[model samples]
Target: MLPASASQLLNPTDVGREFLRLLPIALFVIVFGIAFGLASVQAGLTDWQAILMSVTVFAGASQFATLELWGQHVSLLPLVAVVFAINARHILMGAALYPMLRELPAGRRYGILFLLTDANWAVASQDYQNGRQNLSVILGGGLVLWLAWVAGTVFGVTFGGLVANPEQYGLDMVLGCFLLSMVLGGKRSPRVLLIWTVAGLSAVAAYWWLPPHTHVIVGALAGGVLGYCWKERRHGG
Candidate 1:
């Protein structure tokens, strides 16, 4: 009951290409997740909680933020709001990736968007641009990130007591290092630096001016607006 064109569209080679492309990002995420798990556990999250969050949510930033907010004794509504706002970027991410997913089955597209994150988006974007929009690649990449996140969190929770001054030892700084290394190793672009700088400043400003998760929305909107405005102007729109 499958259309000939549809079957032809979903090529096996595309899956292989996606696998190759996601390998580096997968490694980075594994390492980063382990560090994050260690930080979270030392910060007071139990082993099961950290592991569960990793396996279920698989979002390191939101997970860390939740731990931070929980430590401050913030109420549930505010906590949820912050998590939602911080994750709002995924809406835009899903939109950007929608075109590629359209080439696949509806359920597949939905699943991909639901589980996709910054790291997965980066890999998928590259493949899409390269004309290798393979669904299998996306699945493989997402799985790697998910597993790394869970495994790292479990390891951290188990070994947290052994690590001393984790925050001071720069375990907390691994996210920055991971991102920085990714950029430095890639093409140097002024626009990229501009977006990053704007986003960082906005995050700081939001932290100062807004309530818990409000800053997350504000920072994201501020950075996104800055990036969009610049792109529009560049295109003479």
Candidate 2:
């Protein structure tokens, strides 16, 4: 039998509320998306192509990274490798959520995974750790973010140069600040702190020594291994 949390239905009201809650962050997403659209155009993609990529891929960093590699004669293998390496963290993220996700119907499960991004995933995973089951944030917040990205792309392609310097507004730091806040909000035990320290050091080491875009996965795996080896003591164990 499925756990009670697994069978929990997503409330429409909760979804809408979460969407509104994330609206502020979505505005920042718009600015970054605009930048991406402008860059894509400069990289030789048509407006439609830029918008299509935003709609289909929905991954800002990877999209931007691809822009660096854009040329008349694109190398297919290199492109695929870069995309996979950059977004490989999604594999671990999905695996971390699989226990809860397995409770939903297969279609719903995969549908939710499609919407998973850093922000919504942070909220969902943090809430899950806090004993809350809130997949609505993943779905609703993701919808808002997706729409913001697509709309921003359209605006940039149609009226170019509107946002000349997104960095001036500190737009790039928004998501990082938000994710840090989520991590700080979680219950911090000595064990968890140690795990985080190991992850942080591992990431720094990988950033200096490993291939490009491998630090995140390396840090995550390091933390996972430590957690596995040193399980938290239960209340009565």
Candidate 3:
């Protein structure tokens, strides 16, 4: 059972608001999706196949990475390993949200988790750290982002050359900026700062020395362990 304060109740109005709040980010995601669509086509995937992958897989980075391995006959075991290694950080992200997720019915909980992505997870986790329960962002923001991605893929497939250079427009930085804003909005205590410093240093070290696709999970687990060992004292405690 979660602590009383950790229990998150879903509200329809809040969900709607979060959907609107994330609209700008969704627009940027469309650009990324367009890039992926074009890349997939160049990688020997048909238009339909690319769009279907976008709709079904819905993981842009992993999808792009898989494109590099696409061929007449891809090795199943290697593909699965690559995808798992790339997405292993999701395990830590889901675990971090488990307390709030446990409050919901299992079906609803898993349903919402299906929509979990980097942007909405950043928002929800930051809000939670700031003493707010905002699972609405996961559902609502995720829906908009998913739709934008699919729609952009369709556009790219149909037109095929609308966006030649998404990077030139700085579209790639949109999510990074959004996440930075979320982190900056949070309470900046010494404990939080220390945890962030440790996490950042660990991520850098892992990037330099560890195998590919392991940095995110390594840094996340390092920070999680630090937080567990040095629990914050509640106000007036």
Q: Estimated TM-score per prediction?
A: 0.68, 0.95, 0.93
Check candidate 2 and list the clashing pairs: none
Q: lDDT tens string, model 2, 89-110? A: 9999889888778778888889
Better of 1 and 2 by lDDT: 2
lDDT of 3 by residue, 1-237 (tens): 345432346777878899998999999988888888888898999999999999988888889888989999998887888889888877888888887888788888899888888899999999998887788899999899999999988887777598969888888889789988988898888988999899889989999999888888888888878988887887532
Point out where model 3 deviates above 4 Å. Answer: 1-8, 233-237
Clash counts for all predictions? 0, 0, 0
Ranked by TM-score, top first: 2, 3, 1
User: What are the candidates' C-alpha RMSDs?
Assistant: 5.1, 1.6, 2.4
List where candidate 1 sits over 4 angstroms from the true fold: 1-17, 39-44, 71-74, 127-137, 161-237
Local distance difference test values of all predictions, in order? 0.66, 0.89, 0.86
Best by TM-score: 2
Clashes of 2: 0
